[model samples]
Target: MSAEQDSVFVRNFALVIATLVGVTVLLIVIANSVFGDMDPERQALAEERAEQNLSPDFAVRLSGEPAPAIASADSGADEGGVTEVRSGEQVTQAVCIACHQGNFLNAPGIGDKAAWNERIGKGWETLTQNVADGYGNMPAQGGAASEEEIRAAIEWMVESETGLEVPES
Candidate 1:
């Protein structure tokens, strides 16, 4: 190629290289300034960007079956779920106390931890089940009409005096 043409080509290549280098430096500087230092304005702008990117139904269910009900009358009892029972204390006082005052069936006292130590070792679930279904002299639902009454009696007896954590009904 001619010397003039070669010189022009070399100059064009150098100019292209310089322009690219300038652009790269500018991007790096812009990034460093934007990221390195934080101000309220920048923070606000980023939050705005994030908000714009987010959807109104951000927490919408994307998939999966809706969770099953914990306890419906038709659905039947929940594991460690609240039972439909109340007035347990009254029932216990009226009925259970007669037999339990003597600590029959080896069940614990009202608040005697030593007595309950073995029963508690049997676990809360077993205790609830035993009481609900009837364990020896305890009788089913403490021989009450409704499950609510049974659970209430259990909760009052176990939690109030014994310090057991009873589930809500």
Candidate 2:
């Protein structure tokens, strides 16, 4: 082929390659924005680029499935992934109180001694299971609290109702 023709062919190939690269980048950027940070590839890249020495104690961590955490009565429950140690009262206030406060969805009101008495007699296992599996109009774990958190909230409500303390096992 002639040198001039060869040069023209090279330039055209280069232009095509550059165009393809630019279009690929634009498509990636659009997908990242539309899919948000949940895009696996984008999220992995962001996490890899994030400061390696950053402390989790200062930041909220995200995960697909939360790891199980050991719960203590004095310290409270810690559902893994975020490692937030929430107290029973905190759980109740954040979740249970919404429904239990006024019998919304026929939930037993927090301080309703009579209403609580019958349910409380069913024992901790039954009550906790109910919270975990969902009971009546209440969703499973009500607000999706960990098993320990549900137990704590149940104990807190029982005590508030009848001045009886439920053991945390």
What digit string (tens of lDDT, one per residue) describes model 2 on residues 3-100? 99999999999999999999999999999897855868878877876755465533554764454454555444454423564677889898889888
lDDT of candidate 1 over 5-121, digit per residue (tens): 999999999999999999999999999997877888989999998997785435455575443346566445554444544376887787666666667776566766556655655
- Model 2: how far residue 5 lies from native, Å: 57
lDDT of each: 0.67, 0.77
Best by TM-score: 2
Each candidate structure's TM-score, on Cα atoms with residue i matched to residue i, is: 0.39, 0.49
lDDT computed for candidate 1: 0.67
Error of 1 at 119 (Å): 2.1
